[model samples]
Target: MSALKESQHLKIPLKDIEIATNNFQHCIGIGGYGNVYKGELLIHGKSTIVAVKRLNEQFGQGLKEFLTEIQLLSGQNHPNLISLLGYCDEGKEKIIVYEYAANGSLDQYLRRGSNVPALTWMERLIICVDAARGLNHLHHEVGKHQTIIHRDIKSSNILIDNNWVAKISDLGLSKLGLSGLNRSAVISRVCGTPGYCEPEYFSTGIVTKESDVYSFGIVLFEVLCGKLCCTVDHDGFQLSATVVKDYYKKKKVSEIVDPILKEQMSSELIRDFSKIAYRCLHEDRDQRPPMTLVVKKLERLLAIQDVLLKAAESTLSDVIKPAHPLVREGGNASEIPLDISVLSNMRDFVKYNRLKQFALRALASTLDEDELWHLKDQFYAIDVDKNGAISLEEMRDAFAKDLPWKLKETRVLEILKAIDSNADGLVDFTDFVAATLNVYQLEGQDSERWQILSQAAFEKFDVDRDGYITPEDIRMHTGLKGSIDLLLKEADIDKDCKISLSDFCRLLGT
Candidate 1:
């Protein structure tokens, strides 16, 4: 038993746990040590939610776990760790209470055939770093505490919260490893899940920080590949370990990545992680990088990708403003001919909403004070309640009635937030004007700026299509000036009845 377990004063009542689990009715899942019941508990004198793991009395091994739980988590406090708030030991019945993770186990999100949106490479790195930090705390960070090792580290043992933060869980099979301990401590217990088990432990049942490192590496591999570490032959009986090992050596690493993720993924990340997995699974065991180094490498990858992530957050219209070379005539102009060959790649447009935002920003940059102030006035005039803050519904109504800003809810929200300099939760006259001027400037910029502006304009108008840009089509979508005459006057070049692709390109400076 752990030393901390010996000093606890609170023992949760069995009846309460039973009631929370609906008399053990739901039976959401079963595990090696016990069956987990999805239940709620009032935490810290406030009504709170939590997932209850009821230890199965039927399993002989569960009895040992019951005791170990008390010992391992008696008074430990770590954010990355699943909190063991309390436990119940009623007669032969035993249950461990854990902080409720709304997102459930990491396996559910990373396992093969999971339909959930695949986590980006950056997200995987984040999860790994968090898990490593948790282990680091257990191993050394916690002040003056003996290092602890989680023997059964795997994807299933990593839980995620509603916000997708990862938490290390299931400490039943953990071991304590500290300095001055028996040099042969690891060699004493050869216990852990097979696929994730450290090879060194098999040779000499001695466990150490490296053992946890090896297990974490396997979990990381499982997450990347989205496959079970151990699996049976497809449409056949289970395959042997020898066969799996041989396959690992013979097959190309890319072939093993989950098919769902293979289509759109970072090949560099996959290859790098594969090499890391190979290091962890090395037969020599001594060749693997330390957990700290592994974490550092992953952090470096995240740092390098921060800009790309931020760039994905905006749209093109947010960047560009279509310029009316002439004022509106209140009538439709001759239709512009579609020059299909001159179309910019539409696929790139859908890839990042941020481009549109950048274009809108560029457009704002090109606008003169008069145009900017006029747009701001339009926004304020349309703001009926004068709350200075705009909602999606209000923005929608404005476009439909041609009252002020004609932008989609998403676009409107983006503009409002951008100009609301004070961030007092509202867009005042200054904000409205600033946003308008921004659009105008984007239209008047050089080619590079126009490219960005064009992307944004297409995005704002291409509400249904994925790519391609049409001047008249956009005018109809935004209903900005109603008739194509005003739009053509804004977009037309060389005094033609219709707008040409080259002329449009000139207008956009693309």
Candidate 2:
């Protein structure tokens, strides 16, 4: 009590907390600390909502944790971490207050009950990313001057704000790690929610930052599988770490994923995320990547040849069309003429949607020798400097003789924007090949080689194999940015925000 009072913590009177929580009538939950209530406080004449946790003596075990929580968290500040506001220690009443999390605890949402909205694969990843960030800060930069191990890292402790951002909460069981190191401390007792605790930590009573890593790995699997750890199946088959390890070892981890989330996840996203997550649960604690490496791996898991994770989260498009997709006039394969003029190709290129550009960009990177025969010559012809990349000057000079009208400077930049992969100033081979590839050719479709190349290109771009090409899909598998809206505006004819194989054929046929 003296320690709390001497510090700058807001020491609210018991009467105020009682009034704020309507005389303890608004009990919202039974927390690890005690009964939790939702309430509003008058701060500077404004009614600010807060969560009030009043310690129950019958539980009688958390007085140490209550003080430790106050001591460790009073000076901490992080967006991913929950903030402590005030405390009440008047007589037997020991209460702690926190900022309200509108979305409630994550455990309620994981099961996807009738009342709660299902979390998408992307949302789950973002939440894990948030939790990881919080863990990283706790491990390295806590104001407590100690390496912290959040002994009770669990999904229930992860609170989601109204904005859908996740914040780590409930530090009552957290322990100070080694004096100068973030490694193992051979404590006399084992603590933590059983299923989430690491075998090494539990068996040997040794705890470290890696112990928290092990717990977080359980949370990751919870996000992936949408279940509480060690849950028993209908047949009483327990989905324990051993079960998960077996599934992982057999490469059948997907079989256990929550059915609701299964469709939302792309196969590659699942594979990469699972690999990183399972590594966190390694039996050898030394093998687990530190929180920093975990963050980096999670963030970088989905970047492409520049369809950014940011773009998938927010920005861009991918599409592959044959340089010469044959026009079927009376369905004849040999009679249709292939487009050969750069001016005509450039003019048609202007007609493309961002989705189309995205697909072709990915396609260009993987195009076969047969597909590139004509476009390859055109690329070399424009590369007079022989630098293997096309400068804006090369572009202007190549079409300088052919355009019946003066090429608008904007048109040149637009062409570059159309083909620009990675957003670098000059057009590389991939960009140039993608842009000049004619979208109009009917005779080429009958060629087994062209058909196979087309199929192969689609497979390359659609890394998730979801059939439809979405902005998120392109963002994850391919790498391009800027002008996604412009691309979709023209290319996504149905306005469904994704592209399909028939859509590709239909647009090229036009």
Each model's lDDT: 0.57, 0.71
* Clashes, model 2: 20
Candidate 1 CA-lDDT value: 0.57
lDDT of 1 by residue, 354-381 (tens): 3232333334444456545434434543
Ten-residue stretch with the least lDDT total in model 1: 337-346
Best TM-score among the predictions, by candidate number = 2
Q: Model 1: how far is 397 from its true place, Å?
A: 44
